[model samples]
Target chain A: MHISYNQKEVLKGINLSVEKGEVVSFIGPSGTGKTTLLKCINYLEKPQQGEIQIGDLHLNYQSLSKQDILKLRRKTAMVFQMFNIFKHKTVIQNVMDAQIAVQKKSKNEAYAMSLKQLENVGLKDKINEYPSRLSGGQLQRVGIARGLALEPELILFDEPTSALDPELVEEVLKVIEDVAKSGMTTLLVTHEMDFAKRISDKVVFMENGHIVEVGTPEQIFEKSVNVRTRQFLKKIYAEQDQQKLNIKGG
Target chain B: MTLETGMQELLMEFLKTLPINIIIIILSAALGLLFAVLLTFVRLKRIPVISQLADLYVSFARSVPGLILLFIAYFGIPKVLPLIGLGTYDISPMHAAIISMGFYHSGYISEVFRPAYLAVEKSQHEAADSLGYTPMQKFFRIILPQMVPVALPGYGNALVYLIHDTSLIFAIGIVDIMGTAELSIARSYGTNQILIYFIIALMFSAMCFTTDGLVRKLEKRVAIR
Candidate 1:
């Protein structure tokens, strides 16, 4: 895949694929097109050139049509960093929106499905509350539930916990960890090395729109041939150490 | 006559023409809102020549006086209607007034709509898109509901201005409240002119207050929680 914005390249000839039920995590620094890559999978940010295949559905971006875009979206669900849950809708309605809109479910069926998903995320008590009333963790949990409700073939998470407070990141990661354990094919763009190390079957290190390395989490985290990958992990570990020291001191 | 008696009598005279003024306001508001949505869509979509034309129309509508708009609609539609093959139907002053007011209201109301729509987070659209919502479904379901509360305050102010602008239709011979007030003054040869004008002012203020209040209440009702 190739993505150019205003004639400036964002993703340069990237090629990757996720096997069914495999948990793949793309870990990289910011501005490395991780989110852009996640968005491209669903055509949220149109890549100038690419071919994507999810199951039997294959599309070439250059000749894509409106119908193809919808088909592409239907096959995948995204959990955004900003939580982007509908502000105008109640918590359950937020989950029900796509079920009714794309899945063509009746209100009663959607209500039932959404309730089950919300319950899985432990937000059943907050079903009638609005997005504004929930904390960031709760909101992202709703976002996760909304995606999980669709039962999509692939689910994409674009730095799901990046916008969350440090203390709140664990709750969302716990829910995502549950999703990974459930054998759902998931692609995540995240900065949380430990979380990715714990849950991801394969960890991909990306930098400057290029994949620097791809291996099992142990291979990437412990013994990596790529100098860039080692340096990135070293920096991340240093930051983690600093945070731990600060916590102990305080 | 004392001020109280004069005001009481003139109030009835103004009330007699209230229904006509109300019709103009209601109908033109509906028409203006329709055009405002169309104009907002064109501008946001940026359709080549038509968007530019809409921009020019919005500017003209915003800058020109309602009195001049009334004059143009009064004289111009009769000429254009025949050219469009509707030659037999004559345009009345009331219809002309409504048309002009509708055009005038559209410009200001579109200003309200364009910004309010823009104020909604782009992520909202992306979220809707990621869910595979059709464009129409995204707009009507996701965007429009969110845009309404943001637009209400500005829309209410436009309505208040429209109420005042209705006074200009009297120049075109429409017997609205302002027109009737003028006629009564003329019939009395200008006696108690101050009292009659005061009553007219009182009526307009009351209408503006009600409109503004209703809009505020609605804003609270539909506001995102």
Candidate 2:
């Protein structure tokens, strides 16, 4: 798989194969093309070149029609960083829409499945409420629940906690941690370095549209061979450490 | 004027042509829907030079007075189709009124819908895409359902105008409730313009008010969240 913007490449000639229950975390600073890679997998941005395969289905950028692409998408759900639930719809309707409208599931079955997904995300109580009525963290949890109800084999998370308040980030992260444990192949694009260190089975570091470094948390954090990865880890952890020191010192 | 006699006479006269009025409004609205759908497809396709011309068509229809459209359709169309069916010279103004009202309001309704279709949030499209809905399903389900609530006010306004414009049916010679009232007043007093105008205005105002009232109720009921 590959993603290119202009002449610069992001995830150039990426040949990683993810098994079921494997979790891949992409860690990079802004403009590293991590989000673009995630969008390409979901068929949101049709890559100008490259092939992406999910299980038996071969997804070429050109060969897939709208029907084929939508069918592929139903199997792979992306949890947005912004928690992009339909604000006009209630939490229940947002979850149930894919089931009834796309899956052609019965209303009763869809409702039950939605409720179960909401319960799993610890959001069963807020099913009738609007997205605006929920906290940012709660909204993100509902977003996960909405994705879960789609029954995707591969779930994608686009920095679920990036937009949350510092205190609320933990709640959304915890829900994601639960989803990861459910044995679905999940690709997460995240800025939370510590969270990625703790949760992801494998982490890939990218810069300037290239996979600069990739390894286990220990390899990435403690034993990264690439100079860019080392510099990025230092810069990110240095800024975060300074913030914590300021709070503690004050 | 005794209450019972005057009211009964008025009711009898009004009831006599209410069916024709009902037919006119329903037919015009149906025609309006047909026009809106055709125009929407034309706009969506962006068909070469014809697509650019949709704007001109919408603008021209909207700018021309509905009364003049009625006059033109009743007078002009007959000339165009002189041999319409077995030398029948007396084509009903009812048909001309339907065509005119449908043409005039289609301009406004299409504009209502064009923006309504666009105003759907970006995330909604992404949501449909992620869920595996084809373009057709996305347009019909995700997009159009949301569009109804957005277009409600404009649609309601158009329907109300349809009622009011039924008054212009008199110019084309349709026997609408308004036309019947005007004819009654004219025959009674050899052109009592004041009474004729008052009766026609009051009758249509009442119909338009009730129709608008219903539209408001529907708007509230179907409002998104």
Best by DockQ: 1
Q: State how far residue B66 of model 2 sits from its true place (Å).
A: 1.6
**Over 4 Å off in model 1, which ranges?**
A1-8, B1-9, B81-90
Query: How closely does chain A match the true chain A in each prediction, as TM-score?
Result: 0.96, 0.94
- Cα lDDT of model 1 by residue, A56-142, tens digit: 887888889999999989888999999999999999999998899889999999999999999999999999999999999999999
Cα lDDT tens digits, model 1, B121-208, are 9999999999899999999999999999999999999999999999888898888888888888898899968877887898899999
The numbered model that scores best in lDDT is: 1
| C-alpha RMSD (angstroms) for model 1 | 2.4
Docking class of 1: high
> Candidate 2's residue-wise lDDT over A1-250, tens digit each?
2222332355565556677788889998898888888888888766666677777777677677866777678778888877778766799988998789888999999999999999988888889997778899998888888888988878989878889999999988888888888888889999899888888889999887777777888899889888899999999999999999999999
lDDT score of residue B18 within candidate 1: 98
Model 2 bad stretches (over 4 Å): A1-15, A245-250, B1-11, B45-50, B79-91, B181-185, B188-192
Residue pairs in steric clash, candidate 1?
A: none
DockQ value for model 1: 0.86
Error of 2 at A114 (Å): 2.3
DockQ for the candidates, in order: 0.86, 0.44
* lDDT, candidate 2, B1-225, per-residue tens: 786796578668877888887788888888987897788668767899887788788888788888998888888777767556545365578788888888887887888888888888877788678767778877876788778888888888888887777777877767777777777776767455665567667767777888889888988876776
